[model samples]
Target: DQEGRIVFSNPASHRIWDGVGIEELGQYRGWRAETGEPIAPDQWPAVRAVRHGETTLNQLVRIQGSDGSEKTLLNSALPIRRADGEILGAIVLNQDVTEREASDAALRQSQEDLQHSRQLDAVGQLAGGIAHDFNNLLTGVLSYCDLLLQELGPGDPLRSDIEQIRHAGKRAAMLTRQLLAFSRRQILQPKVLSLNSVVEGLEPMLRRLLGTGVSLAVELDPALAPVMADPGQLEQVMVNLVVNARDAMPQGGQVTISTANRELDIAQAGGIPAGAYAVLTVRDTGVGMPPSTRARVFEPFFTTKEPGKGTGLGLSSVYGIVEQSGGRITVESAPGEGATFTIYLRRHAGPEGAQAKKEQRKVLPLGTETILLVEDETAVRNSARRLLERHGYTVLEARHGMDALRLLEESGRNVDLVLTDVVMPEMDGRELVQRLRAERPEHKVIYMSGYTEQAITSGGVLPPRTAFLEKPFTVDQLMRLVREVLDE
Candidate 1:
């Protein structure tokens, strides 16, 4: 009678364990009645509590009971104590939480799946809209820069200023290209490139950009293998990182860039593929990112800086480019401890070195050959006219596609090129191109836009090799693209 067991189990546990009576509980202590099998002693909470002289809870075990059915149980046990602190025995409690656990696991998995899907969808939509608008802006900047360069005299007082304008315009264009690259919407002309060579080439420009107050250091590995990527894009990534670092420092600080050859093993790194990589690390001594900022740093339009200070696309574009290039980027930062952004790119097993040559665009001569300029924006059209005339071309101006066709019909002027805007009020650039091709196949056409190359080229928006110029372009870009189109 001293070993008698009592039955006052919770309703939940009683139904789960199949424990019916007080005597039955003691008799089936080491067994499960549902499955007519014995329980593993080591896994029994009651045994553990009694042997260890302590209580245990939430311990899981698989057991069979009287009906020969298996059930997973989450159990707890406690030693029954007397008023004099003597341990009488143990009280065992079990709950079958198999269904609950399974349901919880399934729900968690579904949520993760849903979140991933939403992120991918969001990225795609954003990439499309961003690329289109970015290309347009680049087009305008490059075109104008080109035009300005043509007007400057070699020893003119404004020559340096004009050159700087050209340089800044080019950088903006490069930024747009990065946006396109990150979106994987830009056409890539990848070549084998040594990391050391790329960094060395940018030393002068980096020095100029960082200014005299900030220190620039490069710790490139001589043994680093070549990587296959667009050199311009890679340079862009470096510049963007450097610029961000510069902005982080109010009083100026050191920006350290290092590149080394390394291999990523699947087991070693969770996300990046196993391969040889050119690990590029950019570190700064400025204020570091907080956890909240770090989490959203790679999201488009997310920035901590004041409005008008940054476009917030720099890091996001960098993230896109790295991801699109079959590489991975990771950031490390601690509040007030500065920050480091590490980029891992798959290395190409090739040549040890050669400095990448600066691409020189061979500017063609402007001729008296006529060009019909069609643009709705008054400022843009005036600039185009001034730019074309300055280049010694007989320029014809029209406000829209219809007006352009009318000028051609009325004047019967020997038109050489139809320079038109892509987006218009009545008939679009693409439509204008079609009408021209049908009516006057003799005259060549060039399309200009702030639209990304992908958007303009897709869905037969613009024909192949039918010269396209991006909006806000400098004079030189306009002339070259125009000449290139005309000569075609």
Candidate 2:
């Protein structure tokens, strides 16, 4: 008993120190759990207790058993002595708490994820609400600029001033577009596409963009499944991720973009439901973000860059685009360990097909046909009427769908195209089109909207074969879409 060797051990202790017999426990190895530093042989709890008459209680330590299995333990030790204070041996106790600690960590992560999701949703609602109104104002400002520039000939000295004003409006329009994206209100034309194909196409451009400082590595699964998403938006997502990774490594590093087909159960899916998914991951071998930075990484306008260096909308839009396409994005990083961002998109169930490419026609041919323009905002409607009339089109105006019906009936359905806002006070454009279709099945209608979240997005895409125009549409966009729809 006076010796320092472990003479006996219980059955439970043997299991906790798997593969290490009772005789070998005195030489058992462990490290301090908090710092991952080794616990020295001479400074071990039992050794310290027997040698220095010290006591150790409930110390958190991590141990790797003889079988190479790692576990967490709560350890305690006290020196054994006789009545004359003679130093004897030492007693040690350990309770394996590996599973309990892991469970607690998972619970904490779930709670934090839930809270973060709620905050994003609330902010998204606010962003969506204001973005619509901003689009309305931008349309008026930009359309007026288009009108002024049209009247000014090449010799006009005032042309440049109006051009500057037009340029500012366009910049403001881009900001609103990004805001709509972050709010999940921007329109998308999603279709079944191959994730692997997208990555392969970007490989060349990504390499050129990364330059000599950073190397690009692509790992694509041969059996990767198809996913339904807006190809352009998804490409933008990849570009943003690569750019982010590139920025993290200033001197030199490797940026890896990988894709795989993964099947996850409920436990593995985290917040998403159990299903088949297409996973895209971007990992960089560079300095990584801390937990505090990772928590707000997806937030709109949350950037770590110095002032005026970034807009901070890159990751936020990435978050929105993924969510709108019924996917989820997760990021993992620790300081100095590099960062990995993973996106999971649901597998497409329908027959896989590529998006059809449409040929572009830049001609903005003048229209001679009669048209009906409906908009609740007086400024937007008047601006549109003036723009059309200048191009030789006879324009009829209405504030709502009911008024449009009266005007159309009075004209004996002679209008070439009924252009109306999708969101209106009395009757929406869809309802008006329904009634008009019953009366005259050949009537042509074009729908326009600023508040698009509730109106335009039908399962994250537009209705089939629909001619639609987003708000703040530029002069060329308005003209081209009008001519294109009328011809169709």
Candidate 3:
């Protein structure tokens, strides 16, 4: 006892040191829990109490029994002195807190991840709002550019200038679309689909994009659950991640695309609600990201690449696409350890007919049907009308839904199709459609909007059968969609 040795142990202590030999009890092995360093002999609580006639207060420690079962414990030791003040050995008490500590750590990480997600959402909202307004302005700019370019004769200097203007507008439109995506304001046409099939479809294209320097491997979980998401957008997310990985390793590396089913509780949900999730993991053995870069990797226009090499919307758009599809995304990376991007999408148990891919559709040429165009923005309305009229359609203009209704009722069967903006003052497109269908239930409608993050949710941006036309559409896009909707 005077030699700082454990003479005996109680049943409670025996359970904790179960696999440890009685002879080995004389040398208790432990470490400082916080620092993860072995507890020095001088710093051993029981030894200090027994040899120096001291008392050791609660200390957090990591201990492993002979069986190698490690545990975190709150340990304390006190000198066992008799009534005459002669010290005996000492008594040590340790409270196991391994599970509790792990839970606390998980909670801390979840909170941090949630806070980061909110910050990114705030930035996304601002970007989306700006892009929404810009989309309207660009609609007018691009449409007028299209009209001017068409009027200009070939080999004319003005044609080239107009083409340049058109080119610049197209670029701006692309950037705005990315911003809308990040903001989750862009309209989505979600369908129940399998991630495995999606990965299989894109494998060939992804391989070509990665070049010979990068090896692509896909691991699909046979029991993967279906998720409701836009197949095209999911492809975009995969493409962005693959490109990001490829860029990180300019020389050579391995990229793995995998899918699995994940069940998460709120404590481990990675900023989303607890439930069954369809997980898609993209891992790359490439130059990894530091904490600083990892923090802002999903931020719009934030890039680590040299100037002209990147626009920084790649990951941001990916983040938005997943989030808008009711999913959570997380990234793990260290400077030299490479990076792993994990996306958790809500599992869908829709009908058995859930498609592995969207059906192929036949597109149409320019139209000749009479159409009603209802838009609140005068410039956008005029630009659209001019474009439609030039394509041989009789375009009727309306300032709002009320005006469109008045024009439509007066024109009767003369108006062949109704194309309206979703966000209009004093009777929106949905209400206008309701009024139109009240008289003629068979009438068709197409709703267009710059951003539908706040306004649209139901399928097809309306009920089951309605079509959507996104703003800042190209001349060809407008013509093609109008013809298709009319034919349907």
Winning model by lDDT = 2
lDDT of each: 0.70, 0.83, 0.82
lDDT tens per residue, model 2, 323-411: 88889999989999889999999999876686677777666678898888989889899999999898788999999999988887787
**In candidate 2, which residue ranges exceed 4 Å CA deviation?**
19-44, 52-57, 269-272, 366-370, 409-416, 427-445
lDDT of 1 by residue, 1-488 (tens): 11434446677776765544333443343444335366664545565555555788766655556666656677788877779967677787777866886677566756754574367447746765665666555555555665666667788888788678768867777666555555555433356787677789898998798997789989989888888776766787788889888888878889999999887664232255677889999999888999889767777667899988987778877776666556778788878878899998888877744544545477645777888888887767877788788778998899887888888889988777788887777777777778887876665877766544432454223445566665556665666777666666
**Order by lDDT, highest first:** 2, 3, 1
Q: What is the lDDT of residue 166 in candidate 1?
A: 66
TM accuracy, model 3: 0.87
Tell me the lDDT of candidate 3. Answer: 0.82
lDDT, model 2, position 116: 85
Answer with 1 or 3, whichever has the higher TM-score: 3
> How many collisions per candidate?
36, 0, 0
Residue 314 C-alpha lDDT in model 1: 86
> Can you give the TM-score per candidate against the true fold?
0.57, 0.88, 0.87
Best by TM-score: 2
